[model samples]
Target: MQIVHSPLHLRHDGGMELHRGALVPCYEMPARAEYIREALVEAGHALVVPRDFDPEALLAVHDADFVAFLRTAHARWREDGRDGFMLPSGFPARGLRRDRVPSGISGAMGYYAFDAGTPIVEGTWDAAFAAAQCAMTAAALVAEGERSAYALCRPPGHHAGRSVYGGYCFLNNAALAAQQLRERGFGKVALFDVDYHHGNGTQDIFWERDDVLFVSIHGTPETEYPYFLGYADERGAGAGEGFTLNLPLPRGTGWDTYDAALDTALQRIADFGADALVVSLGVDIYEGDPISAFKLGAERFPQLGARLASLGLPTVLVQEGGYAVREIGTNVAGVLGAFGACR
Candidate 1:
């Protein structure tokens, strides 16, 4: 498998986030991607830099105004004479006007962002754009007949919706990759998100379309991050009815339960008769992770990969959340290595 990455990802180095009523150091750091890159290299997987793509590729999945805001928010913050990372102060909640975009940078931040965890730094746009490029490159490789490819994206996307950014994700990299596969001639694409959190952005993008199926197995939204979506009842809408599948596990879930959920997700993908596959690979399910609540061991990653490989469809693996700094690389590489070996 060809692993696509970019050093530019280091640019969006966030400073802090709002967690547990305190501003703590951000868990989604640049070091997450570096650790994965080093492990993949040590494991003998070839790494390649991503090529540039037009902005239209981004507009295909994200809102134009939202993308523009992400590109200029940092500059806007600087124009306001602010220093350090720019985090949202508040959000448009019930009874607030959600239709209008605010004029000031502070209001705009809250308008476009869903949480305070994702900070907009000077290099956020460039780094996020590079990460999207990596995902697109990996998708291109898979569309060109490679059995599978890995996109080592940082600022993990999945929490990002069509027009809102949060959960330390500015761009929905996995959604972009799935869209690329569709434009590259795949008739039907199945996007399976194995991240610990629900891919609300991905689900939002395809919620009304039948061409791409979205499936996720994550912690129950009733007691997890991004606690609005990811219920079993959210089975898609309009033309996409029955195309989306969500298997919400409980807190402290281990390999046995997670494995059963994976089987159900994989079966749904197979039933969809997809021409290609995209996996939003997040390894935060590891018991060692700081911000997440799961109990999967490091050794089970290979088993997870092998299960996905059993589908036998061309796949693109896009990196997502995993906050255990030291073990992140090993867990992610283990999945990739096992997938490659099985393929």
Candidate 2:
């Protein structure tokens, strides 16, 4: 499989993260992508820098004002002489006046963000834009007849929604890829998220659309981060009423249980007869991950890849969350390598 990546991803380096009521070193560091790239290289896969995609590609999946905010937030934050990273400290809650957006940078941050875990550094927009470009480029590869391609996106997306950014994600890369596939003439696409956390942003983007089917196998939001969406009953609404599926697995889930969930998702995709597949591949289900709880090991990742390959659809794998630095590369490599082998 060809790998699309960019050195520009290193720019989104957040220094700290709030975890369990304490500030700690950010787990979503640039090294995560580095390790994955190194592993892909060691496994002898070719890596290519992503090409520039039009900014409109972003607006295809996100709100225009939100995109404008991401592009200009750092400059606004610096103009106010704010020190350190830009983290939101306030938010609009239930029953609050949500009609108007505030003029100040702080208020805008709070207005546009859902959590403080994702700190915005000066280079965040540049890096996130590049990451989205990587995803689009990888998707274009599959659209042009490649069997599969991988987009090694950093500051992983899957949490950031149409108008919100959090969980270390600013741009919804997977959603962007699916939209790109639609623009490339695919009548229908299937987006399967295998992240440990629910792909709330992804679900939100395609929640009411029928063109792309969104399915996620994730930790139940009841006991996981982003504890709002991702329930079994969150079937799509409107034209998408039956296009969305959420298979919420319990904590400490291993290969057997995860395999079942994958099978169910695959069967749905088969029924849908999608033109292409986009896998939000996150390895955080690894037993050793610092912020997630699951029991998947490296040995089982290849099997997961093989299962996806069995579908025989053109595929694009967008990197998501996987925080175990030590084993992250091996785990990611196991999946991609096996996918290539099986294909």
Candidate 3:
């Protein structure tokens, strides 16, 4: 299998994050990708760097204003002589009018972003851009008939929405990659997000399009980072109705329960008759994860991969959230290796 990555992703070293009501050094640190790259190298996975893509590709699923904000927020923050990472103070929730896109960087950031978890570092835009390229690189491989590929994206996406940025995401990498596949002549693509948090951004991006089937198995919003969405009942609307599936497991759900939900998700992808599978692979489900609640031990990762392979679909694994930096490699390698070894 091939692995796609870029050095630019390292620029997004997040500031402090809340853990058990105490601010701690960020778990979404630069080392997360470092360990993934180390593991991929050890596992003999070929690494490729994605070329720069035009801003138009990102424009497809993101508001132009939000995109502009991301590109300029850091620079603007620097121009303002603020040294700390740029973070938005408030967010627009369910009742707000999302139709009005902002005109300035700060206004745009506030308009699209959700909370303070995702701070805009000096090079966050470049890092987010490179991360998107990494995902696209994998999608292009699958489009060319590759059996499988892995995109080790940092500032893990699946949290940001069409115009919003938060949950440590800016450009929805998995959604962007899946969209690229559809635009490149793939008849159908399935986005299976196994992040601890729901792929709210991905869901919003593809909410009205049936071309991509979006499925997520995440922590119930009732007790999770993103508390507004990711319910079992928030199926897609319009043409995308019935194409979106969300399985919100409880806080302390273990491997057995997670595997069951994963099985059900894979079966839907099978039943959807999709030509490719884009997995938003997040190992935060691991028992040791600092910010998540699932009890998925490292040993259970291979089973997760093997189960996905049982569908026999051409898969593209895109890295997402997993805060336990120490075990990220083992869990990531386990999934990729199992996929490689599967018959």
**In model 1, how large is the Cα lDDT of residue 328?**
94
Candidate 2 per-residue lDDT over residues 1-343, each given as its tens digit: 8899999999989999787678888999999999999999999989999989999889888999999999999899989987678888889989876777899999999999998889999999989999999999999999998999999998788898998999899999999999989999889999999999999999999999998999999998989988999999999899989999999999999889999998999999999999999999999989899899889877888998899899899999999999999799999998998899998
Alpha carbon lDDT of each predicted model: 0.92, 0.92, 0.86
User: lDDT of model 2 at residue 204?
Assistant: 96
**TM-score for each prediction?**
0.99, 0.99, 0.95
- Model 2: colliding residue pairs: 236-241
Q: Which candidate, 2 or 3, has the higher lDDT?
A: 2
**Worst window of 10 by summed lDDT in candidate 2:** 16-25
- Model 2 regions lying over 4 Å from their true place: none
Q: Between the candidate structures 1 and 3, which one is better when assessed by TM-score?
A: 1
Q: What's every prediction's RMSD, in angstroms?
A: 0.7, 0.8, 1.8
Error of 3 at 283 (Å): 0.5
lDDT of 1: 0.92
